[model samples]
Target: MGVAAPAASATPTDVAPDAVAAPPGDNLALTPPMGFNNWNSTHCRPEFNEEMVRGIADLFVESGLKDAGYEYVNLDDCWALPERDENGKLVPDPERFPSGLDALGDYIHSKGLKFGIYTSAGTKTCNPAGFPGALGHEVSDAQQFADWGVDYLKYDNCNNQGVDAVERYTAMRDALAATGRDIVYSICEWGQNQPWTWAQDVGHLWRTTGDITDTWDSVMSIFKRNVELAEYAGPGHWNDPDMLEVGNGGMTDTEYRSHFSLWAMMAAPLLIGSDLRVASEETFDILGNTEVIAVDQDPLGRQGTVVSSENGAWVLSKEMADGSRAVALFNESDTAQHVGTTAEAVGLPAADAYEMRDLWEHESYQTAGTISATVPAHGIEVFRVSPDGDWAQYPSAVEVGASAVQSEAGTTAELTTAVTNLGRTPAKSVSVDVAGPEGWTIEAGSATTSPALATDAALTTDWTVEIPPGTPGGSYDLTVTADYRSPRHQPRQDSLTVEAQVLVPPGEGTSYVSDLAFVREANGQGPVERDTNVGSVAAGDGTPITIEGTVFDKGLGTHAPSTVEIYTAGRCDVFSAQVGIDDAAGAGGGPPQRGSVTFEVWADGTRVAATGVLNGTAPAQPLTADVSGASFVELVVTDGGNGKNSDHADWADATVSCTA
Candidate 1:
């Protein structure tokens, strides 16, 4: 299924000066490739063996993933020995793949699945163990992969010895062609060189960003970077923003849904990066959404474009094959927000009404002209809208939003909620209700019902919420519901949920933050550590905290995009720490030490103090912030505008001082 070759180009550059200006004609990956890769969940771990791979293949068939358009089952790094054989051929790790690559490939083929292998364009792979790469051995390695029945190849860019990106990638493209096998070539250059401009005919898909961690910041950052490159993707090639971290435990189900929704909206590849054997039902439900998958695999292969974005609310639209528009309303803020767009704004033909199908909810609704939703924080709502489909009567589009409230234990606080009707028709008998957690009291302070709500009209209610005495300090949810009757007298309802923070002031004097249980914590790489250094990629593998030959006994060790929120209850006055990148990133290193991070302190959502970008080569710097009369203090670490390669950050001797 190769594309027709174009005339040879005269652009003189590196290795392939006469390289054709079209993709490798193998017509693979017409749409973004959907499959599984064993890297994010089990990276070079002992559990990533042949038995595990075989079990994944079985689960794909049993879990309906095979039927969901997932075709490739790929292996990442650490599947091979450190060195090649005397014949200069790559050798599979005997202990990991005792049956060898040929047998494993055959087993995968028998199950109606394709096999994929990985290699770097540099001299060695990215792992610290440094496995053999195919930089100078492209010919022999390509033949080896072809002989082993490989259907796909993910050529990575690590330790490339500063070779030209196009030259290095073009060598492998030509080498693969010489073997006479139709293999999908994936360019993993990490988007450092803007491969999208020239990779149209060189590879099937190109990574537009760095490696993705199972964190919200990582996901959002990658999405922002790749969303702007829609013009570079088409039928045969794609813009891959790395693999899917759907089943990973770092993010919530809502955030994971947003992750999947945005990726599908952008027409990115749907490669599963989590362990399927122990996956939860929610994970399977998110991955097996065929309606969403259809948009990704749509034959038109048009990537969605951002129509409008403001204040963390985004609206995107993708042109479908049947003259429909797949629209997404994404809310990136911490509170529920209303995101809206018109049919004409999405380039759809004018009509009396448009039929909208909720891709996530699998429900159908008719809209006069407005397509909108009250999207939850870090959540997404996707719809497939067409003007020529079965249209039903337009119903009331009620949206709900709430203001956040903070209260001390054993005290009462006021929360305000607003309900708005955005539809053309009016709603009758509209009533509101609020519910709190067990042992908490909720009372309505204003009128909770109205006879009729007209279009663009809003109703507000104030609720008195009480926190129980002696309740632990943390975050809790308040669920608000609105019930109304449509113009046709049909019962309709909508719900809004928001978080409330409760404060439990610490005792007067100084206390080490490591000794306190945080209200919430999130890390980019692994679980946040206490009194130790940010260790390897796995949890509980940390060593003693050491930075610039200095050791600390009490502190927090975490990765980039990390947050640790501690209760202060308007009593804390000072917070201090010695912050820097952990020395372990540079210790026992094969490649150059690579890590960059910035430290920040937030008091009641306000950044009080911060540090510039710090790498492993810099020494620890003292940090202090004034957090007086603040309910909580947030310690944050962010990736320093670069990739999160080795951003192991440490907050040593972290302490907070409180007044009596």
Candidate 2:
């Protein structure tokens, strides 16, 4: 759900006629709201129903997440009828929300949790989940939400009919307050309207970017975009970089830990966007890390800042209430990197000998001098600093990532994890243990061994992890843990765990993939605040791809199915496709040039060829690139930063062939 915030210009309206003004000091979100949002998980799919909401709420109560500050359970888009009732009030989609929204709110409240609903500030909400927006009916909808006991409102900015963002959001703010309901207003305008510049008092949190996918690039892109805008984030008024993708399986445990740690340090809200019902244990741990939550929910409300950056490595620091500090060392490279910096570099007094506690590893140390750690590639190490000597909490100091050679079902695969000591001191008697699927036989490096792990030293742990010959192929998380003693710090023993995603492919051999094949999950257009496009698109009716209002220019380019993957395993791999603008991808849904775009073909993430800006004025053009010896080919379309107003583009007759 890497969608930008929705923003547009529109007229305003007054408050509800009969309702009283909200009570004073009704600013509900004293801190960033921690909760669950459905849009990221189910979206407008038929499965996004009341049962899902109730089950999530129940899990929140049962999973000890509520105790960890995850309170609000929000319904992002959908959940409402296409139009308002005769009384000019919003109605829940009875088919999906059988008990209605009011009953849903009551059920959530019964679990001692707050309930939130979604709406847009424009005349029309996001499509497919269509419903009249609050532009002309703000007062009425606000009153209805209050009547339903709604505690929060995620007000979006889709189909604004060209409304000024500040004015529209202000009107909705006044309307919500007039309903006499203390609703936490969340402004989602895709950061396009620069809500941070004007939304101080209008809303609690504002989106700062487009939708976020569960890819390393998405998380890293968001971190880069939102981290620099720390000046605008504080207690109630926060800069949102979209929802949580941790535990979603797209990223590794190390990456997820880094994602969660970084977001918390930025003082962003902790709204989870994963399927709670089937959330794995790893997901629960990441979501329920109250220690990290404390940093984000610190009463000071000051967002963390990047005090130092070098060679793709950075130190993000935040000041806490008790004069303590939180710091994270991030490594964004492909190899492990050691970033050495002092506590003072992260905004701490050089005179104080601060005790550092690793938030993720759950270990403590007393470091009087320089603080340093050898971080894993695309991983992070977080710590809380205090002016106290506390080494008793030191348990284990190990960071690990696993890779498997030959992960096919019938073949015996060798799974290896490199365990690195991130501690201030050396670790003795280092031993690696692995536990995998129930039926699989996993051979370890040793039952007991002594590997002295000096600070920053790496120990390779090999396991002949064999998958049952007939075991169905799928992704499996093999848990890898390191056990050792603190011969340098403490006498007590310690253990640390990491979950490695082992994927078993369908089959091996040369295979043909369609250039028309698509792989992206969500539409380039966001839901609720943008065009209502299908999650999956087809070149239907032997015409252009017309699922939803989105129209692919060439009958050959279908962006909905998935981003085409031109796999190349030989010496003569060629990828070719026709590029054009999607007639409906413009701001006004214009044809051709109105939705100007440049299509770039990436070979294994490196740009190979790009078409010049294409629009209605230009005829369809063909693009071809040699993907020889490349494992993956990707097609990316950009609006050249001109905005995807009507940028409905198409890549027709896409073909990937390896002649060798």
Candidate 3:
């Protein structure tokens, strides 16, 4: 069942390197190839090399991966013999591969699939005991690969010393040209030396990073580093972020979903490196996420780009085929950080209307001009955008009621509401009414009427209105009433409440700092929050165990703390502290002195009994602490700096011991 070879051009079995000719147009065909590699299950050392390759071939079909897009069954390094012949001839190891490659090739072809082999561009193969080294023998090795019916060549980079990788790669490119076969050349340089810039000219896809471990951190770190290169991948050439480790079990299902979401976004080669014989249900779901897969395989070939990286948060977005865009917001902070995105941040039109879809949850939403969402600690949200037409432009009246927004005093914020056509056909006139808090105002043009919204199934319209200037600040409640041409033919109303606060101008308060965020959950339990903010405290000062953050008056004559927490590695339990602005400088004297307090934090997961008054009146002192034999400690504020009750909380740094 092997695919019929396109008429071979001048099958000159012994042609010289320069004598080879290039195909008329582009010869590369596949894009972001979906395939299976043998390293994960085999650990680069399969017990039954030939048999396992065939078994995986069988699984590829049985698992329905071939129909779902996975096709190639690639054998990684370690399949070759210990050495090449003295005459510089490369051959498969007889003892390990007794039937030789021709029979193996036949076995694979009989199943209606292609065959691929592994080699290295350095002096030795990846395992140091493989047949042909790719260095000076590039031509000979490549020609041998062609003669063995090899359809793909995975050229690794191991033991590569001084030889320029680019030059060595071009040498193999030339050598592969000498062979009459149209082989897919894959470069495995681990993304070092920025191989992506030239990968298109030399191979099908270039590995962008080291081998990805079966851990969430490894997968996430790799995805973050590589998603920006989405623009570099295209039809013939692709940016490979190394093989996938989906089913390999070092991470949870949530992490695996994140892994697939990223790879699909980056358009990296989906060469899975897991045990295909026993893939889990979750693995199938990951490999079969059609919405995400569609983004990777989109014809435009454009990759997602990072727009912002502030306050432990990041946003990535990509333009889609239907004239819409997809976006992903990441909260990389230790504690949950409320975050949002404007149309400008994602290169979308600032027009008053647009339709947005949350890809992870597979739900549609609506926004005025800006799209925003709350990002949980270490969590992410992906979105798809479409223009407005006649369909309801926003989420269901019920769903829209859950939207959140935040604003500072004197900052006028606008929220749009609309309904667009999500159906293939156009609809009659549609409209919506928006209402805000008493002090807020629904400005003119807050409601939009678009006939074009009836054309594209993805079109939407926005209801634009702003919060009143100098309005008393606090979480404001907004409501929208939608009148669409639906069968119900009735107006539906929804409401949302967002935290709003006016902050004291910058340079007038203490600065904020944070610690490295780490995953603290295991197994079926979800990840927990751990605040490790450290500040310098004198050697003998007792550490304050109370936490504080800014708060805003809710117009009810009361203010609430944003968030509060404390951390320490010692047994100091009972604690107390007070919170207030360090107003020793007095009002109009410039920003207040540091607002601080004192409290003791314990090492055990025990609570601290402490009380303090957070008065917005005057500045307070920095939180202080004291103890002996204590190695690590930290003060934490769970609340985001919103308003007057407290100046930005400051943590006095402390030292810790390295003993585990």
Candidate 4:
């Protein structure tokens, strides 16, 4: 009935409490721990008695979670008494744990699983006035758990304060090692200190952040931070972002999927923190996604990294066992955007055709050396890449339609080019260099561009740039190249031909586009758009469009909202746009419908050149905004309602148009 127990700490070396213990076997690391924790479900009152433990063990067996690779059964803090035995041995809280510690251990072992417990480096347990133990008691406690055949220890740092907190944990680690038992120590310090750099020497895994709540933002934020610690995780140690809240209330199933996907990519501990005795079927499916789990347990053990990001959308990639790569297109925006990937980014080929297996949709895509797909907002598309031919036998595919488009506000060209991968395995870091045809100089957004090609992935590289005024307009030819490092070959390069046409100084017409789509509704249903296009314009493919109408929003005196996202197809690689509004005076705090506020959206960072101003109140006249160059468009009104109420704002007559 209470939250299931948390596992034992996984570091028990004879050094300081924070010293990393020898890794627990290759077993746990092979697939982040898939068990559960008690903190999210029961908080401070999780019951860890023998009977409760047995019930959870039964659920683990019956739910087929054990068959799905879930092992360790852990207990968080609060199972100990305030006093120890005369011989400096630890004692169980008599009223809570009537059976001897050994009996509980034997029962868990009898269930064909492992058992774990919790403790703190401070003088008290998680309870401010409860049973907390310092050095001697800490060591003695580890000995007791070890003597009882515990497999893991979750060492929390609640109520412990000092400048050298890491050192304090290290002391307990040494004490545990003295017992001669191989117990995995888990450091639950809540990321107060940067544990990644040092926790490896102290425990098997360390909590990389504060506790996680069952909210979408909570899950996303934790994951965002985990990416920052990718370099510090490896075979013996992992980053623990607390535990999973998959079955807990608050977030939706899609949100949980995102949570799981991100954790797997980060190669973090897979401890579940929910009530499993009666979890829903949806929760079971999420917990049992073996394909996604495979990526997490990839033998390389290298955590996924963010190669690039705009707004909240992220491009994550991980190395696989066969020297191939797994790439993920992710959308983190509140709305939706377009998402896509190329072979070069995955380290494949630039001149040869390739093939891709979309993990999420369970489909296959073939490209003439480049690959691309559209993703929705807050959604993801995971794919496995393999080579289509010999790494050295193929020739670079022909490049096509290389061109540059520039933003009026800056000196950068939005370069669009088509390139291909010729080799077999996937390619990593496909890129292009931008310069003027001859005397013209490249400015702003233009930088080195590379396409991530997976075996036969063929896609276009879409990039943008800002051009400085007074630059002469003329015809210029630019070179586009695909640089990649495949699993079978050292590194290779290919090229494309591009012709830039900078129009004469325009003193007449202004042009642009904003594509629109219906991403979500008020039903609390997760966004219909892909996770990778929450705030971009590609929608799904790299197409162009023009805009010619006026856009307006009516803001209440106290509230205003202004944010929009564009999506292309179901993928999230090409959608992009932005919106903005004039700041109204005397606006109070709240939702957009209740008051005056600023609203705005941007496309490829151009602020959408328009004649009308963003108004906090109704537009001077009914204005129709024309959107172009986007696969889909999303609109958002900030401060739509007063903090205390909902339904304060309304949107109407919004329309979208694309290239003819």
lDDT of each: 0.86, 0.70, 0.55, 0.57
Model 2 earns a TM-score of 0.68
Off by over 4 Å in 4: 1-31, 46-49, 82-89, 93-96, 349-355, 361-372, 388-660
Which stretches of model 3 miss by more than 4 angstroms? 1-25, 85-87, 93-99, 110-112, 128-131, 228-231, 334-339, 350-352, 362-370, 374-377, 388-390, 393-660
Against the true structure, what is each candidate's TM-score?
Answer: 0.87, 0.68, 0.59, 0.58
lDDT at 37 for candidate 2? 92
Pairs with steric clashes in candidate 1? 1-27, 2-25, 2-27, 3-25, 22-201, 23-201
**lDDT at position 611, candidate 2:** 80
Better of 2 and 3 by TM-score: 2
| Arranged by lDDT, best first | 1, 2, 4, 3
**Model 1, runs deviating above 4 Å:** 1-26, 81-95, 98-100, 127-132, 159-161, 334-336, 349-351, 393-395, 487-490, 514-524, 527-533, 536-545, 562-572, 585-620, 628-645
> Highest lDDT, which number?
1
Residues 44-136, candidate 4: write the lDDT tens digits.
Answer: 563656567677788888888777777788877667777777886778776667887688778877878788887776656666546755644
Per-residue CA lDDT of candidate 2, range 1-660, in tens?
223333454423333312322222665677889999987678789878999999999999899999999999998777778888888888888999988888899999999999998888877777545577889888888899999999988887777777788888889889998987789988888777776766767888888887777766667777898998887776678899888988766677888988999999999988999998999999999989888999999998889999888887988889998888898889876445666577777777664345788788676765544566667678888889876545434544455555633354656777667666655566677777777778878887644355587666777767787777776534465666666676544444333333332333212333323312232222243210112222222222223444233453333443321233333434336767656654444433444346567878788778889887766455557788877777556667676567545555566555666544
Cα lDDT of candidate 2 equals: 0.70
Better of 2 and 4 by TM-score: 2
Of the candidates numbered 1 and 3, which has the greater TM-score value?
A: 1
Sort by TM-score, best first: 1, 2, 3, 4
Between candidates 2 and 3, the lDDT winner = 2
lDDT per residue as tens, model 3, 472-577 = 4334456554444433344333333333332221121221212321112111111111221111111222223223333311100101222222222233322222
